[model samples]
Target: MAESATALAIMGMALVTYLTRVGGLFLAGRLPTGRRWRAALTAMPGVILVSLVAPLVLGAGVAEAMGAMVVLALARRVALPVVVVAGIVVVAVGRAWLTG
Candidate 1:
């Protein structure tokens, strides 16, 4: 059935994603190819995060993009919970203001 196929596809995608992240960790831990290789591995997580988020942020309107900027600015200085709250507040207020 279509529903069963969709579920299988979702599971396949999830399995592949999990394997890729785990494979990166395994390689990073098990291999010492060189400094450049290690550095690339070290940057993998950030690169993955940006890849996942950039599309959503770029496709969204000003409010969402501004919220993402606020998140980035606050992410380093503040705690995760605080940053999340700030982003939510900014996006909500921005949307309201823009819509008015």
Candidate 2:
């Protein structure tokens, strides 16, 4: 594609993303803050995370699988940064061990 086309595409994507976020916030503010709604909203992040990660995990190699497992274990008991670091370390080590 031409440079101008690429730039236009990027701008379009950014606009779409910005609009989606703004629309979500706007709708959320208008939604009922009942217990069920609040619980669902609170769980939305985890649901989204799993939806994103599930495909990668299912298609992953042993090293990636090990890393995902490490992340899962740490996720329940530790902060996100720690879980991320541990997952990276586990994947790297597992890959090295497998290759060596």
Residues 1-100, candidate 1: write the lDDT tens digits.
9999999999999999999979966765677679998788779889999899998787888999999999999999989999999999999999999999
Count of steric clashes across candidates, in order:
0, 0
- Candidate 2's C-alpha runs over 4 A off are 1-3, 32-39, 74-83, 96-100
Please give, for residues 9-75, the per-residue lDDT of candidate 2 as tens digits: 9999999999998998788888999999999999999999989988787587899998988888888
Best by lDDT: 1
Model 1 scores what on Cα lDDT?
A: 0.91
Scored against the true structure, residue 42 in model 2 reaches a CA lDDT of 99
Q: Top model by TM-score, which number? A: 2
